[model samples]
Target chain A: MRKLFSSRTVVTIIIAFIVIVGLITGSNWLSKRTNTPPFVQRFSNDLAGGVSRLISVPTTAIGRTANSIGNLLDTFEENQILKAKIDQFAQDKVRLQTVEEENRSLKKQLGLQATLTDFKTVSAVTISRSPTTWQSQLVINQGIKAGLKKGMPVLSGAGIIGRISEVNTTNSKVALISDTSEDANRFAITIKGNSGEINGIITGFNREKNQLIMGQVTSDNTIKAGDLVETSGLGGVIPSGLFVGKVARVTKDDYGLSKRIYIEPAADLGNITTVVVAVSEIGAK
Target chain B: MAFWQLTRIRVVYPVILFFLLFVDGAVMSGMGAFFTAFPWHVLPLATLIWLFYGVQFDVDKDMPFWIYVTATGILFDAYYTGIFGTYTVAFLIATMVMKQAKNILDERLLSGLTMFLFGILTFLVITYFAGYIIGIANVSIVTFLLFEVLPTVALNAFFAVIGYFPVWSFFNFLR
Candidate 1:
């Protein structure tokens, strides 16, 4: 058994250790990068992405069907609630159409080709979510081949959930807002304050509290609870006017020097099946 | 004349592992309602099960096996975790430690179960710790142990126990 620790084996162990270190450092490097990952990895990810899609699509469908059937008991109550909202929804639909027409005509008169809110969307299915707890992520089937680019905002039916962090040839990785990693990018956002628009970055996630903390608020605007928060589109990547969530609470940071606004995400981070990748014209040449 | 025997072990084993990995993702995809409180459910370790299943078979932890582990680590990084080196290092160390433990313990059904469970612990610890160090993972040690480790172990152990005999017999047949 001493031969297990022989010179050759020791050398092999050392080499293995070096490889591990290299891999870890490489991963950290990739995390900080906003650019597309390596070509070979892209190609490999494409192939695996295809296989995973094949497996997850059917499996997820089957599971959802089972889960929905189990929820049949609640549907009656839910149906009553929906039925109550149908008349209100029809009125809102007409109002929205009128506003849309007015806005278009105004933009045409102004000769504006595009605005911060103008965007095209490519819909994709959530192929998978990472099983590990630390990093909250989703693998969507849409990738670079589908005109998806890095930093594109991924929205669920409710609101923006995450942004495309890594885009491969045929698949991409969406880093969810729930991630608390230092390396993850913060979403540039604005809160609709009573005084004016209060701007900040969605800087941190408190998983235990189930709230997203918005920080870097220099403005002492009178922000209150239940205020609307949405994308400011300060950064060119995400489109403007995407609904983020309602302000859950507002508090001072640990130092008590600045305000931190906590938002309850509108996107059902857990139940996202299909997502829309919003491609804004701001940075696209 | 034939250098290759146990064709099923060599070829079919990986195929099954692949599906297991996919199923792992599928389980998480559907468990969205419970995502806020507990994001992951039943993190199916195909490699760990592969190890458990092959305990009775003459499965060598050789160069090819190590390469497969390394490859799996890379794929895991790119496809799932998106953090490149975490699994490569974690899986390599865990597999090596698991093999060492196997040598020390007698090959009984209970022992095999113990080793399998222990293997899961080692893998989870190494992975969680590695991710923590890299500043990518955000779960506190206490939280990691309570939420991630507890559920994962319970479910994965149940899976191992349920599949142990059938998998062993299947491998036995392959031989």
Candidate 2:
């Protein structure tokens, strides 16, 4: 028994324990207290991103081929869908033209300037997604060197995907809207009713249904299914008017005092390859 | 002279382990992108594999092997973002358990396979629990076990099997 508790093993174990404790505390402090990622962390991520880009070429090719085959299989159905979309798009184009003219006239009459959402956009390609299951973060190739900043809104072709979580010199990480972590609850958004006055907060993501759960909605608000939801710009970082999603359904909360609206996200969060970072102008509110 | 030779031979392990870490972070992640449809989360558990290999081959239970395990764990934690020290502590505990159990377990292919499976399961459970305690993991136990744990175990086990022979041959060649 005495031999089992040898001084060497005891010392090693103690040292290991101290090291473990130090690491946990240090990392937590770094993540929470620091505004920017440490230089070592950024360098490592950039190096890994570069290597991942090189390794992704073959896999990207395979993915492209698989997508091509799937597209080919669905060509006839897609063609029909496209035909229907074309007619709808033609009508939308006319409506959009009239709205644009009215918007221009209103801006001229009011002498209003461009809003925060009218920032410059820089394109970026996803280098890798974090392997950890808890967080759904994507590392994009462009970073602070390209004028990307933390809290800047990221948009896909469809609509808003997420916001920049961390920015390094050459790459950045985007924390997806599906991330249900407590730190990820900064998105202040609103549901656009016919009256345009319904406001709610995106509380969490329903993974089973693949929907965003928006809660804190007043029972008095006449929100219904199919209402357009968007960022309220209430959170100073994210600009207003960025499309979030359509309300799939509305239900009473457990307390039955407020409503919880399930949103079908506009951007496909699961399968993103490229994104645009909306770089807000300096000092833009 | 004999001690010097042994130290020189053991140097290769750390080199190989570092290389594996790089490949796991860079290459394996990109490969995971291809399997978007399936719930296939392919993370390379090279450190776990190294622990298994150490359990199987290091009959003498050398100090260098333990150091390798510790260093690999620390490096993995440094590279991966999340609750730091989770992997390091998990790997250390796993190594200690394996070292204690090595006497009863025979040095054979079946034992190696069993150890590999058990090691991976233990490592993942520890990681999950540690992350949960640190407030990083928001996943429920059932969801984590089903979607993340099961797929990660299966994929990592496949990597361990494919990696076994080459690693075995390399260690032997180093000797």
Best by lDDT: 1
- Tens digits of per-residue lDDT, candidate 1, A108-226, equal 99999888888889999988877775676788988878988878888997898888888888888888888776434487888898898898788888776667888867687899989
Off by over 4 Å in 1: A1-19, A182-185, B1-7, B34-42, B55-58, B61-63
DockQ of each: 0.55, 0.31
Ten contiguous residues minimizing lDDT sum, candidate 1 chain B: B54-63
- lDDT score for residue A81 of model 2: 85
Q: Residue-wise lDDT of candidate 2 within A1-285, one digit each (tens)? A: 348688898999899777777777677666655546778777876776676677556645565566677669999998998998898899999998999899878978999776544567899987666555455577788988897777788998688877777777888878777677544545778887876577657888876566888887774767778889888777566777788899999898999987888998898665677798776553244
- Please give the CA lDDT of all the candidate structures: 0.76, 0.70
User: Which regions of candidate 2 deviate over 4 angstroms?
Assistant: A1-26, A101-105, A194-196, A282-285, B1-16, B25-83, B91-103, B173-175
Interface root-mean-square deviation, each candidate:
2.4, 3.5
Work out how many backbone clashes candidate 2 has.
0
lDDT by residue (tens digit), candidate 1, B66-162: 6766676677777787667777676766777767778888888787777777778888988877766666566577877776788778877788888
Per-candidate fnat, comma-separated: 0.57, 0.24
RMSD score of candidate 2 (Å): 4.5
Give candidate 2's chain B TM-score: 0.81
